[model samples]
Target: MKISNETKIGVLTAFAITIMILGFNFLKGKTLFGTSHTMYAKYTNVQGLATSNPVMINGLQVGTVYSITTDKNMKEILVNMTLTKDVNIPVNSYATIKNNPLGTTTVEIRLGDAMQYLPKDDTIRTETSAGILDAAVQEIRPVLGQVKNAVKSLDSVLMTVNSVVDPNAKNNIRGILENLNKTTAGLTESSASLNTLLNTQTGALAKSLNNVSSFTGNLANNNDKLTAVMTNLDKTTTNLSNLDLQKTLTTLDATVTELKASLGKLNTTNGTAGMLLNDPKLYNNLAATANKINVLLDDIKTNPKRYISFSVFGKKNKSEPLKYPLPDTLNAPYIILQK
Candidate 1:
């Protein structure tokens, strides 16, 4: 059968329109053949939720967001979710709008513990979760403030450095660097000298080291003698430590007290030694007696016949006793006058 072109054109246009309607409904999350139930949720803000977004139950996609609308008061947004007929949501179940990291939003349904289920078209509770971008902004806020403070601190430090580095300070720094260079050169020379002094063949340090080594060797060889000497020293110290120092001190103190008493008696002229020391008359009499004895000896030497006339040939010379002390010319210089 040959159809007319006008009829064919009309049929094709109608089929295309029908296909577009079906596709539009599908895109809007309307089930074409399968059965679904509509559930409602109200929120102050839908958080960018839109129709055709997936509706999830425990991370499983069970439905889609059917529509979003505002109430008559326009203070709240009402969301419609079309869930599969098989999904039995309990009473008091809630829905939350979730934003994915990839910038997509979904409606998540939470089941309640009540045995009774919510009827279709009933409005469930709604909540909004913080998106990744919002959370990131929240976390970075303090860090941004800290970065800003660090920048300010850096700027302040730079200003301080600029203020401190003046022309005089620069010259002083240069001078210090020059002095440090001189010191470094001097240290290098000293190091070389030290190396020379440490030479093993010809250096005094080597000779000193050799001497020390020899001394140590001698000490090692005399180790037994040293030990004996040390033992003797220990015995001497022990004997000294064992002496009765307290008894000696007590005896010495008694002797000192006796000596002090004797000295006190001597100073008081109460004893014979004290009288001899303190009486001037007695001292003068003794001096006189000694002078008389000395004069008699001088007279005897001058006239030997006065002492003995035993020799018959010798003249009988009568010598009177010397009334005063005769100054012996040989011994006169040895006399000491008593004041």
Candidate 2:
């Protein structure tokens, strides 16, 4: 058998392409020959993830990322996932990329509830994301700044305390003790004066304490009386309950209704109170009376002696003044005379 060089190159290329395709399918967590259904998820960033990436659950191969494409609107990277036909996903299922704390990263889909079945070829929404480590690294700056300021404040406080508590600047102990003794003597005298005050008010304090004790004793002694009153109240309530409560309530309702009707009648134009309330003639009479009173007050203001007369018989006037006849409208209770 004689093979040409051109045929050998073509065979090698075809074998290489087969191996590459199989390797890609294996990396995507799929059997190279198995059938899969498609789903889609969008990520803010692809995070070095690419086509043919394996989608796994609990380290088991389930599916593969079929393709990764940037949105034409330039918002997100959309990932098309081709999962095994048997992998049932709930509608609430989500896909997330997980990196090993120390190793290569991969994508995983979390099946929401095993109880509920997911139909094939369902698109899962990526509503939440586990943020990148870069975001947390950005926060270290402000925290470090605060730590620096706290250290500076501590240093300033130490400096102030050092000046205040200098060994050479500390005052003499005996002088301080002497002043303290004088203060204690004054306090003792004040305490003695306060004790004397208590002695002076002792009888009143004792009487007040006795009154409090008597009140407490009365409360203690009347507990049975209070209990008996409560018992009587309960008996009265039971007796009232034994009466025709429904009929009594009905009567009360009727009486209240009648009272309301009577009150309404009082306010209506037909009744006497109603006439007084609604009548224009009554208001006109009131206005006339007010005007007359205003005029009388004005007259008294002009000539005080005519309306208000003061006479001192013993010391000044030496004669009784004539008493004016009291008017029915001006029947006030009392009139006080001033010296």
Global lDDT scores for all candidate models: 0.85, 0.73
What clash count goes with each model?
0, 0
User: Which regions of candidate 2 deviate over 4 angstroms?
Assistant: 1-32, 100-102, 113-115, 127-132, 135-156, 167-339
Query: Compared with the true structure, what per-residue lDDT tens digits does model 1 show for residues 212-298?
Result: 999999999999999999999999999999999999999999999999999998887777999988989898897777776777777
Tens-place lDDT digits, model 2, residues 41-151: 888876677777777766786777888888578688888887775666777777888755565556777778747765666668664444457556667768888999999
Listed in order, each prediction's TM-score against the native is 0.39, 0.36
What is candidate 1's CA lDDT for residue 164? 88
- Global CA lDDT of candidate 2, please? 0.73
Superposed by TM-score, candidate 2 places the C-alpha of residue 33 at a distance from the truth, in angstroms, of: 4.0
What's the distance in Å from true for residue 114, model 1? 12
Query: Which pairs clash inside model 2?
Result: none
Give the least accurate 10-residue stretch of model 2, judged by summed lDDT. 317-326
